[model samples]
Target chain A: MHIDTGSWHRYMALPAFLLFSLFFLFPLMQGAVLSFTDWDGFSTPSFIGFQNFVDFLHDARALQDVRTTVLFALGSAPLLNLCGLALALLLNKKFRGKQVVRALLYLPAVISPMIMGSIWYLLLQPKRGLFALLLQRVGVSGQGNWMLSSNLALVIIVLVNVWQYAGMTMVIYLAGLQAIPLEHYEAADIEGASSSQTFRHIVFPQLIPSLKINIITNIIGSLSVFEAILALTDGGPGYDTESLSIYILRMCYGNKTGYSTAVALMLFLIILIPVFISLRFFNKVEER
Target chain B: MKPNTTIVADARKTRLSPRNRLDWYLLAIVVLISCVAIIPFYLLVLLALKSPIGGLAAIRLMPDFHFVNFITAWQRSALGKAMFNSLVMTAGGVGLLVFLSSMAGYTIARFPGKLNRTIFTILLLCMMIPGIINTVPLYTLLIRLKGINTYWAMICVMAVNAMPFAIFLYSSFIRAMPVSLEESAIIDGCSWFEAFWRITFPLIGPVTSSVVILQGLGMWNNYAQAVFFLQDKAHRNIPLSISLFFQQYGADWPLMAAAAFLGLLPAVAAFLVFQRYFVEGITAGALKG
Candidate 1:
């Protein structure tokens, strides 16, 4: 098994490597080059290095999108981890109908973002939507146009994102929770450690790795928000819910492919900064 | 809950243990959170079955006995054919991914070399390229290859885009496995490829299933790239079709609700049927990350 011919070795890795280079790497390089040029779809792209990015920087809507993207990522990721941790703690214990509850929580995630957003679009449609109708059933006015309001739109988008994804973090934390050694808790108990003391001393530190994983992923996913926001608000009520991805899509439709690519590169860089920092910081903690 | 087998029972044995309690408070919290999570899905089905009088004016918990909305969505959206396209795309894409990456992963794990290591690292880095960034370039590449609007184009891209994580999972699982099984097979006059096919491949069942569910669900729910590549209405996937349906029926809330449910049906059904694999796969992927 150890003595493999050079031909077979190449054979084993050829398909994946070929596919990756052609589909993933080549396109990325193309995007990189495209970012520096001016092309409006049909016309030939002319070299305009740094100009597209310069324009993007000067663009107020693009800047607002960056702000919105950052806010969404910041608001959603932390709350996702917190709610997930709480749910994980709650579900970690043996309980009746545990699987049913877990499946229910995860159901939202399985639904496509477009569908989820559309459902919420109906539910939050101010006057005669599900929420309003339900509220009216209880004799409370659901009169406010939820998605039409700029301030509430971004908040709703972020909340809907958090709602869909918290279950994933919960499942992660549950896995981390179960892997905790039973003897550690027994030892803490024998030492007469109180409930909060047991959790603080024995559980919290151990779940840090899980928390780190959830945070990084939630950050990446939320920052890439597009379909849901598109379906829900279409960045409407005036750019309040316009994320970077949605901004890029809208630009592409406006025949500003080069600029959109430049914007995408910026968004990509913005997403990476925190992910790398969190990963490095957490790896250090894990080592300790 | 178990008579003598659970941590709960053990906790109950400790007189002053906080875990000794029935944890009703925790259960209530879990139930409430689950309700919040599930209400949209619940309402999706409920409203789909019932007719709306005036742009979603009616709201009821009980599902009406009618599925006229379903028929309307299906016919108006041409969803049946579109769903077929999506199913084919997912199967072909995920199948290609699992097969190719598993072989590559096994090779990488079994054979230790600088080339393989560099390749794996490079593959991991490829994912950092935000997906939207690749849209235009990939489209250009597809056009150059005369691959635009073809099923294979989408399938290949899906397989390749998702290959990094599939390789990650496969290689990780393969690394954790003992080499003795493959070694014995090779010693019995089986070729290395034959040994992998017969032995090594069979042993990596959990990770393989994980790859299937993760990538399968991903492709099923994928909409953005499909919108970019599959421009023809004849070739649109389920998510795209549903989105199109909603746009056409912008004011028809009940029909839109039905379309959304129909689009979500495949993924939701997959999750329910393979709930165990989905949970295990997600948990394992998270931990590995």
Candidate 2:
């Protein structure tokens, strides 16, 4: 049957595309134009010509947030990959009630990060937290709050992020694992290859597709970390742990609309660089 | 085959013993990891069930079964209304997303014309661009459109956010399917649009279900955009309501826990029921995309 190339069927994409353009593309383009102006969310607009971008370079808080955001991604992404890959490997074998165990491991990821953060806060809230209460039951006392320290709070946020999302990464990796033909393993065994060598040669190469997906998504998710940090620290104790996303949100509402848009674009660039680097790196690996 | 039963038995015993012991160790680690994964949820249940009178100091592994905190939280946080709002928005968003994305995917997969290909490429590109950049301008656009505090507004935004991934899933799934079925229907005098709905659409049920489960859960647990779009008590979704409830009653741990539990219940229930689809959806999307 000859399919019509110029039929109205091509227009099937129109509705979704139009809606996307209206809500996503239109605003993105408008934001691009607004980044150059001084709209201030309420005042008359005037063109600023990269002044906001220049200000972001000099703004100590913004720079620190860039640090916080990058640091969180650096900490969170690799740990997530490691923990997830480990869990996937551990659970890859058939065992009794393996489905139940997998489900339980992935349960937290299904819950909202905000809710998970709140639940964690209750369990870790300094002297009054469940941990502290347990410690008191053991006759220990006077421990300091980890949340009060900027670095520790950031670290805790990174850990929490990994804890929540590792399951997601595991699920993807598990799929990749399951897709491997059993004959590959048998062949490796016949060759008397060590498990480590087999993994490095056979498993790792085949899992690159999954690795690319998880790494890219995790990087994007980590860089734009918002709900977890918002729910945990609210970028707290003096904006110490504010991420670029959180900073942009505050500035958007804090009457720095034009500058916030510029920062938001800067965030896009920040996200883009790492993502492109990784994509290029992965492409090269896949080619090899 | 029946020549050496004793030798066969001895070989099996030696072979299985060490592996059985290793399996036991693996099982123990698996159970321990599962426990660690679930401990925070257990604590959430404990805190949600604890009575407010004793505060956090009296918290323990065992719940007091106060149960009243749920009721109080439901009443005070206005979560009933919030739940309704969440339901409306999630349903509307998922419905719109599935409808539009499936059709778009079908066309892009089958047609692959210049327009369709360009649209697909654009959507993929937009998927990488952060949504935060759109916040300020989108807010202004929403105000101009009078979309703040409205269900349709939230639905459109959520659906649009989910569109690229959904479309990708559908197009890939459809592309893998043979075109003979839809081709026959078209040759039998059905229009392409009619052929899709009659022949191809129903066949893509798995992809549709995956999209629903994945994007539905996202819209339900959405906090980032909901926090911005669904401001004010009247329009608050589950995440926004629970957030505001926590802020107002920060000291009331029991009540706050209860509120959070209420907010998370439907998502947990949905995940439990459709978990297989959830995993399949993520795998299909990530692996294929």
For model 2, how does the per-residue alpha-carbon lDDT over B1-289 read when each residue is reduced to its tens digit?
Answer: 6659888998765543332234767978998898888877787888889986766776777899999999999999999999899899999999999999999999999989899999999999888886777888899899999999899999999999999989988999999999888778877888889989998999998888888887898888888888888888899998888888889999988888888988889888988988788888778777877
The alpha-carbon deviation from the true structure for residue A165 of candidate 2, after best TM-score superposition, in angstroms, is 1.2
Model 1 chain A lDDT-worst window of ten: A1-10
Q: Who wins the DockQ comparison? A: 2
Model 1 sits at a Cα RMSD from the real structure of 2.8
- Tell me the whole-model lDDT of each prediction, alpha carbons only: 0.82, 0.87
Model 1 clashing residue pairs (backbone) = none
Off by over 4 Å in 1: A1-7, B1-12, B15-17, B52-58
TM-score (0 to 1) of chain B for each candidate: 0.90, 0.91
lDDT of 2: 0.87
